[model samples]
Target: MNTKRLSNQGGESQHQMTARFTNKVVLVTGGGSGIGRSTALAFAREGATVVAAGRREEPLAETVKLIEARGGQGSAIVADVTRGDDVVRLVETVVARHGGLHIAFNNAGVLGTPQRIGDVDEATWSEVIAINLTGVWLSMKHEIAHMSRNGGGAIINMASIFGVHKSAPMYGAYAATKAAVSALTRTAAREYIAQGIRINAVSPGPIEAPMSLRPGETEAQRAERYRETVPLGRIGLAEEVAAAVLWLASPESSFIVGHDLVIDGGVTI
Candidate 1:
């Protein structure tokens, strides 16, 4: 009986150990800047070969450079998440190059034109949903298909705190899309858990990123506003959010599925 118990414990120990993603293949969408860029770099540092996709060529190149500088392997693919053809090709190229995909971060999104619900035009709403919601679905569709072929993998969707709560006025379209992301994350997790695929989300509050601030907002004004609003008394940095993403991707979170890891500096508290 003691020998049998020891064998069982050893099996559990093997599952719990965390070399995690060594030699795994990871793909991150919107990986050119902000949280996406940071996530890609973090994955590379952890010994995963990365495929970073984005709309712009320059930022993708820069991310690839950073990964290579650290003696890690990564490639940049120029693709817009909103375009179905681009997304399909992006997944295909990654699988062809790496033989299999072990992790996918569907982090591409857009805030869209801020306006009141009644004032939001059809074009504006469509644009926001297309990129923020529909694009994520497309990425999942392809990634799941690929992962299914090779046993399974993990997927992390980038949501926002607004996904769980209401935003101020004029953020109708953006907030709605994020809320949809949360629902989709849970749905996918349930659909694929039995197949060795894990799906989860990361909802960040107001991280310091180029896209978070408005075009004409002064630095001081933005800083003062965030200081007053956030419970932590300061805004979060992109690297902090990336850390959460890395945790979800690693085996340390193997038992955690369908959960939204909220990183808001205690603002929601």
Candidate 2:
């Protein structure tokens, strides 16, 4: 089938002629910024009706506007991932408005405050778990419910290299939550594949997003540090991670399931 050619923000080169996500409805959690926003736009670029779900409305709206500007369909839904009711409604609303949900990126997460494992406060720990771990779980639960009954769909949860491959000082809560996301994605993939719901995850390392910077650390400092640590000698881009997510969501990765593909620059190696 022929695909429509569209212009990007920077007058960049064109996308591939094949529209892999044509007629697909995609839901991306935490679509306000970073990887979430990038993935949402990527889906839209490929002809998907994208829904950006997040707790805040402003950023989500911004993401939708960016999607629309590119001649792709986009919408924003404000919903807290930690609440089951909100998550259920988020999924239902997507279906209600778009007709069906074909892909979901459970990417809502947070890097909690820096603190040693023993020195971490309860509130911070709970908040991290609620948003990162519990949030992904709730999203998959409702998303699977809709996909399994209506036919199959794809899901990509956001994990991290910190938990899947490497860990560091003062990141106990963040690491724990990401590790759980990896495990949950693997297990859920097995349980739901028979029902036609494909699930996988991407554990990205330091990237060109605010989340990659340490508290009070400057961009130059983080870049210099990654130059020494990451084999790629630089920070990863949100678009890079978004490319991996789109591949997983597409039929290209049909045979792969329960795999937590690490997108780090050989940090584990």
Q: Which model scores highest in lDDT?
A: 2
lDDT of 2 by residue, 39-158 (tens): 888898898999999999999999999888878899999999999999999999999999999999999999988889999989999999999999999999999999999998999999
Model 1, position 197, has a per-residue lDDT of 94
Write one digit per residue (lDDT tens) for candidate 1, span 81-106. 88889889999999899888999999
Q: What TM-score should be assigned to candidate 2? A: 0.94
TM, every model: 0.90, 0.94
Q: RMSDs, each prediction?
A: 9.4, 4.1
- What pairs collide in candidate 1? none
In order, the Cα lDDT scores of the candidates are: 0.84, 0.89
Which portions of model 2 show Cα errors greater than 4 Å?
A: 1-11, 14-18
Q: Give the TM-score of candidate 1.
A: 0.90
How close to the true structure is residue 255 of candidate 1, measured as C-alpha lDDT? Answer: 97
